[model samples]
Target chain A: MSKRNASESTLAHDTWAVEARGLVKQFGDNRAVDGVDLTVRAGTIYGVLGPNGAGKTTTIRMLATLLRPDAGWARIFGYDVVKEPQIVRQLIGVTGQYASVDESLSATENLIIFSRLLGLGRAEAKRKAAELLEEFGLTEAAKRPLKNFSGGMRRRLDLAASLIAQPPLIFLDEPTTGLDPRTRAQMWDTIRRLVKTGSTVLLTTQYLDEADQLADRIAVIDRGRVVAEGTVDELKLSVGTSSLQLRVQSPTDMDRARQMVDQVLGVKSVVSPEAGKITASMANADQVTDLLIRLREARIHLAEMSVQKPSLDEVFLTITVHGVKERESAAVEDEHELEVTRV
Target chain B: MSNVSITPEIRRSLKNHTSLSQSVRNSFTMAYRGLLKIRRTPEQLFDVTFQPIIFTLMFTYIFGGAVSGNVYNYLPIIIPGNLVQTVITTSIVTGVQLREDMDKGVFDRFKSLPIARIAPLAGALLADTVRYTIATVLTFAMGYIMGYRPNGGFGHVVLAGILVIVCSWAVSWIFAFFGVIARTASSVQGISMLILFPLTFLSNAYVPVDTMPKWLQWFVHANPISHLVSAVRDMVNTSAFGGSDLVISLVGAAIIVALFAPLTVRAYMRRT
Candidate 1:
């Protein structure tokens, strides 16, 4: 941790670090970001998670004042993104998916340029550049051109460049996309340190684990709209029930295991696959003991049996796939009922 | 949702949000950063330093005898012509650097920055002026070394140098626009040269356009490069100041900046 703080002189005190309503962005004929509504608190990590081509980048661009939304409005740190962009610019710093620093310039020079652009005096810019180089552990390479820095070093320098003036709100769009695991961890630690100092961050990433680790709240966007938004545990609960899997020693005993599971659950629909595995959805967690007893009485030698909950990947698949199917069938039923009514 | 476009509200509101002066200031800052990049790499100096030396020597030796009957006789003509050629050739760096920056994700980074959207594009053009000036001075110095005497002396030489620098700076916007829109850096260079070479070569640069075929003469006479070269020749070779060439050069510069500046800025702003 750099122990570097955004002093009153460097910080822009503002409320509501970011806010957006019905924001939309399009590229050519494709709606890259559909209508999105988001509100991030003053000093928290608001993580936007989505699959590739899910409009995360487009939404971020609109919020950062990089792209103009086709519809609706957005504001950052209490300033309307379209109407008060200069004030918005002064209050925020952005670290993009790729390193944006000039490779031809030394790391120190890169930071100094940013510092000057941020309106720092020449000496102040120099001092701030040195401070950033030290904080990012790039002091030794400060005088060397960024082209010679390794990937991880360049990314760190890129991040350091963004923090030169220590704006109150910072936008990081896939900041760790191409970094290695170790480098990614280092970058995450840096971000954690930033939050500790009360800087708000709007992070867009495809990595679910990253959201789980860092985000105070997560918004999962798909097809340009937020499909779900909640804490991790809350999202996991949306699937409705946990699943239990039992592996019997012999494939031939699968039918017997299925019968036992059906008897214990009082549901004739329990499934037993040819691989000697029995899986059942358990709405009541208290049935574990009865299920075990039934398995023992069936004389099925078990290799392994465990209770497990759905993961984020499973939750995502269920929502996108099953939810869509459920909607389609519901529409079909409504059409059928409408025909019946007309008849 | 599929048939999408930037709404009129966004366009109208962008003007309200982003001011022209602020954009120009942002553009200048970006250009200053580019100037810092040139300071760091310095290896980009090969063209400015080496080209002036080679072209000055080669043209003076190769064309001097056939045209002026002696190398010394051609000094006054060859020096100014080579200076114009070298500086203009150096303008190719505008597109090349822009392409390189775009390739290296610099523009992607710029898109996220909240500054004026045109800053990066404008800054890139600003930074290459340093390179053009270096070529201008070096070519003149090399000419001085080759025993070329300008009838216009030091003051006129300085004016001519400033003139070439300004013209090249304006010319660079054309290349900068190419850099922004071109798919690759090599292609920007190729395309810029495809437009530059014939204009410089066929003009009254190395020889009088009057001695050629009527068709060739007309093309040469109307070429902007001819105005620029004639402007330089009047200043350096004859110790005279003419308003016509200066007007042509300034008008040409104004037209290029007018046409490309807004187009480039608009395209650049829409990129994100």
Candidate 2:
């Protein structure tokens, strides 16, 4: 009890905090995460950026050893996630996209249970629970059951629970999703503080700006694959600063819509035939006004349109050149029957 | 929404050389958590507290005169019967609570920890003994209030109580397996009651077997619930410490646990 395992105590600086290769996980007929690869240097924040149902949580689950990969492999601090999980468990902490603390227990009790489970002495566990609750600004509600806490308070307690053991590598899965801006900013500060103190952090988020604010590197995942990976500047330059997606009212107008998009944006665009839509990368989002005006003048009668900040459905179309070609030539499988609910 | 199902993680691939002491400590900690839940809610004890008293009083009066010609004469037969029935029904709560506890997010946190895999399950099963004891004590007290006296003496009465509580704990493992495997908490309740109702009602727990038609009597006498009830009667009424029924009851409880504990753990481990 007085000594620690050598492997658990030693964390070499040169080791990558996270290394994953061609990882895959499938649920039913859905390959939620297909062939994702990532590498993060120690002492840096890595962001897995994706939109809803983009498999961000699934990939994080596999990395955290909560879900087994269908294929490929991952290692945390050079320990194989599958083969050396007990070692990996000792080396990492995980905070899920949802609050993981016991809802029926008070904030203090939840933290104490988590601490005791991690082998802390009973008195030490109690002290740590009180310390963390106060630090998270939850001291006032420490005695109240978690069911009484608000969303932000619950999320704070969730992170506080993860920090008890302070494992070398921490997984924060969308730590700020659904939070108010002030709370989100506070979470960001807390995350930055963790990395500053020598812990390597990996977070998943849907906001590109969040990645820009926190991550040293960002992986843009779409439909179960990493479409782009680099610093924020490099990814933005390659995927186009912003992109646009326009779905027409009818499928027959898709070809003509693509032509108008190419003429207005002055860039080639890809046609997603079944969706009756066209997607194009733009130098700036301000250029969207010109394209919309031109389509109106040409009487394209668009059903729906929007310029997006490289959302999950748009990232792969623009980042992967071969993916563009494949979609452009693929046969139209289904006609769009989208009810034009909006005028 | 982070709805993670049980995914097989190479079957504890992150193997730590967990000493028996650490496993025991982990189990005690988890059990403590279970006890905290009981204390916090307190209402969770309502079934065990109220159901036994209701059954003991209801069954003694309702069937007492019809079965044995008077209420006092029926007290001896019905006390043990209601004891077995009340405590066994309480065992089903173990499975129901376990199912309700496994919200994927909380379960994910549990799985990510390095403690012994069985701690949470074992702790939940152990904490349920509190419920069993409550039901056992209440049933006996209700019998005492209704004028039933045990010639087997206070020691054997206590022995009878321990035997039922122990058997209920063993029976709970069967429900614990259902908890891990069922898709919903309500389904666990439905399936547990489906299995328990017939087993309890059709046995000698509530009725004399000879009065039943011959076809039903065959199944009722062979029912394991009957063996448990008979064992309790032997201990309380006759002070027969080592009857064949007692051996059968003990062995039956052992077999139930041995068969269901691993089966439950296996189903829980299938994180696909």
lDDT of each: 0.78, 0.82
Q: The CA-based lDDT of model 1 is what?
A: 0.78
Model 1, docking class: incorrect
Model 1 lDDT per residue over B1-272, tens place = 01111121111222224567767777788888887767767898888999999999998999999889999998888888888889988988887888778777566556655566677888888888888889999899988898988989999999999999988988888887888788888899899999999878988879866679999998988899888888898998787886699789988988988998888777666554
Cα distance off (Å), candidate 1, residue A222: 2.7
For each candidate, give the interface RMSD after superposing the true interface residues on Cα.
13.8, 9.8
Alpha-carbon error at A331 in model 2, in Å? Answer: 11
DockQ of candidate 1, scored on C-alphas against the true complex (2 decimals): 0.22
Instruction: Give the lDDT of residue B61 in candidate 2.
Output: 96
Query: Individual DockQ of the candidates?
Result: 0.22, 0.21
Clash pairs detected, candidate 1: B31-B123
- Per-model TM-score on C-alpha atoms: 0.82, 0.82
lDDT for A188 (candidate 2):
95
After TM-score superposition, what is the CA distance of residue B192 in candidate 1 from its true location, in Å? 1.9
List fnat per candidate, in order: 0.35, 0.39
- Candidate 2: residue B160 lDDT (0-100): 92
Give model 2's docking category: incorrect
